[model samples]
Target: MTVTETTTAPAKIWDKAGGWQGVGTAVGILALTRVGQLLMIWWLGGATSEPRSVWDRLLVWDAGWFLRVAMDGYPHGYTYENGVLQGNELAFFPVYPMLIRFAAAIGFTPSTAAVLISWIASIGAAVALHLLGTSLYSKRAGWALVAICCSAPASVVLSMAYSESIFLALVAGMFVAAHRRAWWAAGLLGLLTALSRPTGAAAALGLGVAALIAVREIWKSENRIAWQPITAAAAALAGVPLYIGWVAWRVGDLDAWFKIQTAGWGTTFDYGSSTIKFLNTTLRTGDGWVSISIALMLLVALAAAGVALTQKPWLPLAVYGVVAMILVYGQAGFYHSKPRLLLPVLLTLLPAVVAASKARPRVAILSIVAWAAFGLWYGAYLVTVWPYTL
Candidate 1:
């Protein structure tokens, strides 16, 4: 019996080391969680007489902008209709639209392509997140991280026509590459990520930090430094500026990107004053459960940051998460969407998972399940109740 147990333990270790077992489990969890989201949405819609088709439901708000961009390229200049300045496709990033266009070229409608791309990218994001979590800790932590990510309150965006999944997949891939010291892969992934979303620049920052770490290690050893690190660092730092510069050139203003975001969509960076005002107004008005939910989300983000500081597991991840939160919450616009914005900064969940793991086994399972249940409920609320610009 002892010999049989010893052999089985080695087999289990080998299975984990092989990588497929953990990834398969993570993907299964992701798929099942998504099904739960679908069922909840369907049931709620039926009960409330909302009766929205799945495609129609997914293509709301920003999804329309992406579809417009894919079907019709950016306008030449500021588009005004009947003396009112209308938001143009230029405000949206190019990578997602390009993907939509490619799918359209192959005979898929823009809307179908958008949903398809988002779902595929979501799966990729989950798998990549799993890989990154495993690389950072153990396979168990990897699975736990996936649970947090897939069930996030705003993770419904992952199944929509938004760039979140694309950006997340690339971000996770960049970090995984950085961890493996594959500088070229990290650099290229970071470049693509920068094209996907403005926050992609935060991922680049993380990559640059990783490169700096590699440099220090090289310095510690009396060995020759590799060109990979330098190239990766340069690429990571340059990708965002290059995209912003292109946008500026197109609009014929050096600060056109910021101008478009501000003038077109009312999104501007006011150094947190707007956020403060928003919180004050929400509190004063007593917006009920939604306000409480948003406040709780803010607390979760802060707690994650605090836990990361205490654990100090990975500096790049810590920096990436901190910067992402700053960008999400410190910005002036779309206060209601702040929780959604913070969804991609997935490292925030690591501390919670770590804490859970240290607890008694049944307690840990119950707590994690409760967290996931709350996430699912909150996500359902975002989709059904009090519509915000998610």
Candidate 2:
């Protein structure tokens, strides 16, 4: 598959699982993790070129493009700087910018509003993840999922002015809706998710697969058919194509978006050849810490995927995690970003954490501590020494 093709729940059981209190605890843990990261940044003198305050450092890298999009919509033509084409605003999705624009229009600077949007979305995502995990397994597993997410090496991106937090929250919401069999709600949330990130197609595919299995089971058990769920399945599958069609119409080419991604960012599909080359280069150099860190994260992802296969999480969640991982690893460009891209595969880690916790609570807690420590170090390294996109 090409770049466009490759890129890539549920709740309830309310009172029994501690409900909002569980969510609150999970968010609190994530917030504290963010605080630790902030302190690390402060101790490291921040990542800005001129030494600005830590609070002002959130708007770097892709955050700048998002802020520009919020402040001054998408440009009609491509942009270039010093003879090289720059990333276009059209490559970014609209939902996060729309929220930032709304927040800025009220009373905040675009920078402040963008950070606030990310922070709030991070908490919301924590809550949604808690609910989804609890509904799937035990309350312990739910808490474990939150702990793993908040401490993952890329979790710092959750607190930055990026769309990962919002995408995570919306995708978690879709999972809950699917679990509850609220087909329309799941479809609508999946649509919103697609509008937030290119990986949204993974969620749509997972939900559509789940809906099909549901319909099959119904057919096996009963003599009746349900149109609402079928409609929901169709709606869920439609979002990415709709957005791509809009892009095609705007640029007057069916593969305009893919070409833009390739030209602007060097992103394309090479069936893991790029990843293999990156790993080989890093190993041969013996100094590329960034490459080494990304490689370690990829190893962890493979382990998590193995755990998912062995543990057998809900079919939809399992499918979503696997597909998301494939998209992340299958991409050709930006090998350093593999860790950040894998952030959406939160479900893949759930089974591993839960199994560890169930078999040995002490070891699980120790692993969580180590994970958080690594995140703090890597997060700071990304800003301080590496100068790579997080």
Candidate 3:
């Protein structure tokens, strides 16, 4: 079906889900997943030799970078450690830290504000995911999307001081807005999504595709252009370059942001050479279970994404998924972070969610529970026991 036609029955589908009641149920499922993951973190944290509170564990790795940006602001130029230039807070996006600062100004500590904002955004993400699913398919698909996404292996980031929650919320909301032809909302949300992370560029590209489709339909029907979609597309397409340009102007270097990312996190886009090498080595002789598991997850995700495409999802969604996967797979970075980076790529989860939505209630529930059991525990283990960054 065309994008416009697919969204025509949203009101009927929303009523079928009981409207707000269905939304509440999705949020409730998200809450349950959060509780389960937190409990796992608490248990795992206590058993570690260097036991720390669950709160502290949630604030590790990138959380510290975000908090630093919130509290101190980005550095003016390159940061150095022992005369070696390093990645600075400039590599991190500003929206999440800006929100953290805003929340902190109202009376909470930075860490508390960071986690609180993340939790709130995660709820928003769940709501948006439900609406997107319900609009495109059915209420069952909506709930299934929420349950699967919330219980994904790296979904623990949803509750932590990470920007993924806010990014997910904005991206999903933007998709819903675009699907509904709410160009104003889509443009604004698209802008925010772009400001959230580098991956936002992929989302903006997807939005651009949606806008193009709208424009073509308008031309075919009335021999006229749709200015709203065109304007929204322009706004979204501007987001990434705007931020990068600002960084360049501020730092007096054209590629300052890219430099910072490469220096700090080894995040250069190497066209998948690094990833292929890692997979080859890991499959051949990797010793660590974690490394091996991560390699396998990457393969499984690629397969799942392929399966999703065969199902012929919405055009914008499929575009976003393809580009996002390219960015994740083509990058030369932490091998273990691929799954976390893939969390907001809704396409990868479509197969399982659709299957669950079609199954009997008892069967679906048991299947999701089994998936969540390992997913929740695996995320908890990474944060509590793994020594490296997620």
Candidate 4:
């Protein structure tokens, strides 16, 4: 047997995931998990709960802008009914709706296109996770990771017209390529992930740093300087300049974006002792009792996954896990949905899978099932109910 097959991780992880078997499994799981979310959106679409409050209100975050961009390319006017600004619409990235608009231009309804794209992207992510997991751990760990990922409430994002599903797919896929030294593929995926979300920079940075280290270790080889991660980082940084320039042109102020966030919305990025403060405040909130509990649990699960992750054959995973954790909960804000925001950081699962491979085969399977149940249920509630009203 070859190294991968004879060692621990199964050959399936590195097998051609685009093959019929991978495609079939990936498609099957995506369909089953996303059904609930698609049903909810289909059921609730165009239905009004109250005159002032429509289905859009329940959607919240970038969902409104997605629907708006779907209906209208980009509204020229601004409105501020809630505490957030409108018009500039910089809070919502352009890639997602750009796809929606492309679909609408070609004749697909925005909602329908969103569902299809998200499901496909989410399935792609699961396959990436599976490969990365099996490579790092055992075949069983990889499968378990995919199982948990599919069942987790985050699976619901695949149903909505949101960027998270696509974004996570790119993020996880890039890391898989990166771990295997597939620099060009990693860079391309990293670039896409960056364009898809604000945290794209973080993803690019992780991959780029990992690449630099890999080169140093493989310094004797001329082909080791793969520019993909570097290129991806540059592309991600490009978004900031492009976005800021647009904001400046619109408001005629150099700092228009920062000003809008503070003045128009009641948000300020102050890094005090606030991670703790946010947690303390959250605990005090009888308002978000369940949300607060879920948030804490996600954090705990991540930490547990980190511990399990570091035990793997790879050191890069441990490094990535440490930095990712610091980057995640390090924020000093108290948004009830902050845990969900860290969804793309699911790259941690790649390394965690490898670490988990050390477990006895039976025990590993048992552990995976348990984590899968908790993750799916916990993720489901977080996406559907908490942080947003029922």
Candidate 5:
């Protein structure tokens, strides 16, 4: 081979991997956001009467549930507390906890393993987000996407023993693979994404849309059908049902999973009635700043999703964003958790990232840093001072 070919081959591979510089920049931006947020958490924690260490704080709320799952495994039936059904480890997905269990088996404590897995997954998420953005837009947009997402409100979960980081990484990577028409990777990632969270159902549906689009284009142009996209879509679509079916079989009830969720967390699809009522009441008479802020954030997310539609993003992404928002808005659950749930709705952040990518470098950096300042602090405050489950 020629000397030019030898050098260019590695460059081509690196470019396909989002380029060394692009991925490095994205991870660097994520590191800064995480550090700033951790410091904020420490400061806020110190102000409390019973100060908790940052490490301890990261293992609070849902972290405990994940740890239980990692160490003890899921119960065979529903849990009851004081004769009332309660949410249990079954409500949590298995993949994150499974990884934690694996890590712990290698010698780390369960808590340490959980936190370590989440942090590692978050870094993977940064890389995936960068690749997705770079593929859809540009390197600047990729870096901006990583910066915006890692510092968004409730992004503290990325640093905690939570599954959001793993879910985000898989979902973002799945999207990137689908966009690039890598059927094998897309299918595997999609299946894994589905197993990570209930929201994976929406993600799988989005993958289906992408697959259909690819199939249609291929059929029109090549006069022959491509089976890979269809097969990938089928694999993706099966993930949610597969898990739900397992839960049902284990509990010997068809609706066991849904019942557990509803009983434990009051999580059920209410067709947005609960969301509407919450917003109406919060807007009219809610006195708490946190509640007010959450309500506002929900509204802003809806507006942003609408604006994103106007930008005509890739159809699959649009479908995922719309369905995911519907799921988030249409559910009856913890009111404060909406922002965290919305963090992976990359569509909502598209306009801002696109605009930032087009702006002067200094302007973009300043804008993102300003956003990170508030976003990171908001997340830290939620974990440190809000005194509730996120």
Candidate 6:
């Protein structure tokens, strides 16, 4: 049967045995990807340029700051003056750093804990992504989804000490659980997303919207939302207050979190016209394949989002993608980094995944393998070829 004729729920769930294979494949992918990333780091360490090398720069940039804060709890020290805000450390949000600090208290060093936690969360990310693909298309689609995500060059974030993997896992879980009508699970995950990343706003919004549509279907009425949807709405709302509260307590101001984002983090709105500006500059700036690839991918990702918006199962991904693009591209003074910023929203490409799954079984399997191989090599090459990033 063609994928469209089938409702996906039954045909998409793994045979009970496929679960084991999935886990094995996930482990293998994670190991090799992480090893490749680390090897690049080791290769860069001996270079005379030291931190100025591509590997050193990428490691030291935002990720390095996060690792430092994760290792040392923010003392809430230092005031902004003379670009000292850079050292004052007001640029980052508190959640992921808190996770690193808490994990370290139990036993793990900040860096070790960050990598370990991120690695584990990457698995969660893969599983949630699989379920999302299966929900929209088929079980075979889920396998393909997981394979691409696990190996995507951007998927390397899973091995890093960053919040993308953790946030994606939680955000993806929120949507997948909502699709299954698991109200409390969805609500809880939705709430956690709010706390995890600033982009949590987008995830929460997407989740609440998806849940409302779902609750309507479940109750066969539009007037009153079910408990799950209400819970999700509440969870999504909770982030604003939590953010405000933290800002108030730390900065002695109601809008400190967002204010710092604007004043300190360098994020601002360009309304996509600047996206054109960015595209032009990058193409003219003696750019290489990596820059061109990222610029093209960002545009393609936006188009795919239109396809995602039509279906309920994929709607959350669409909403998140649109919101993410605006937020990232709008504030993006640096156009070169869009790949890492937006790549975590892999579900935004669901239509493509679904279309690929429509192929005959042998072709589908081969397509998945090729995609994974590309991700592995491409991601490795990004770091290896440049050697000085951030």
Write out the backbone clash pairs for model 2: 8-199, 9-175, 9-176, 10-175, 10-176
Candidate No. with top TM-score: 3
True lDDT of residue 98, candidate 6 = 77
lDDT of 5 at 24: 80
Which window of ten consecutive residues has the lowest lDDT sum in model 3? 6-15
* Residue 323's lDDT in candidate 3: 100
Question: Which regions of candidate 3 deviate over 4 angstroms?
Answer: 1-20
Cα error of candidate 4 at position 35, Å: 4.0
* TM-score order of candidates, top first: 3, 5, 1, 2, 6, 4
lDDT of 3 by residue, 59-123 (tens): 99999999999999988888899999898899988999999999999999999999999999999
Q: Tell how far residue 385 is off in model 6, in angstroms.
A: 4.8
Q: Which numbered prediction scores highest in lDDT against the true structure?
A: 3
Backbone clashes in candidate 6 total 7
Could you tell me how far off, in angstroms, the CA of residue 188 lies in candidate 3 after the best superposition? 0.6
Which 10 successive residues of model 4 have the least lDDT summed? 2-11
lDDT computed for candidate 1: 0.77
Residues 62-97, candidate 6: write the lDDT tens digits: 676677777765546345777555333445666677
The lDDT of each candidate is 0.77, 0.77, 0.90, 0.57, 0.88, 0.65
Candidate 3 collision pairs: none
Model 5 C-alpha RMSD vs. true structure (Å) is 4.4
Clash number for each model? 0, 5, 0, 5, 0, 7
Tell me the tens digit of each residue's lDDT in model 1 across 1-390: 110111101122123452446888888878977787777666665655566765677888899899888988886666677987666778787889999999999999889999999999988888887777777776667777788788888888887788988998999888877776777788888888888888888888888888787776766664666567678878877877887788778878787777778766677877778777777777678777787678667876888778777887688877888888788777877766888888888767878767654567687767767776877767766777656677
User: For model 2, how does the per-residue alpha-carbon lDDT over 108-168 read when each residue is reduced to its tens digit?
Assistant: 9999999999999988788888877776765667777877877777777887898999998
Query: What order do you get sorting by lDDT, best first?
Result: 3, 5, 2, 1, 6, 4
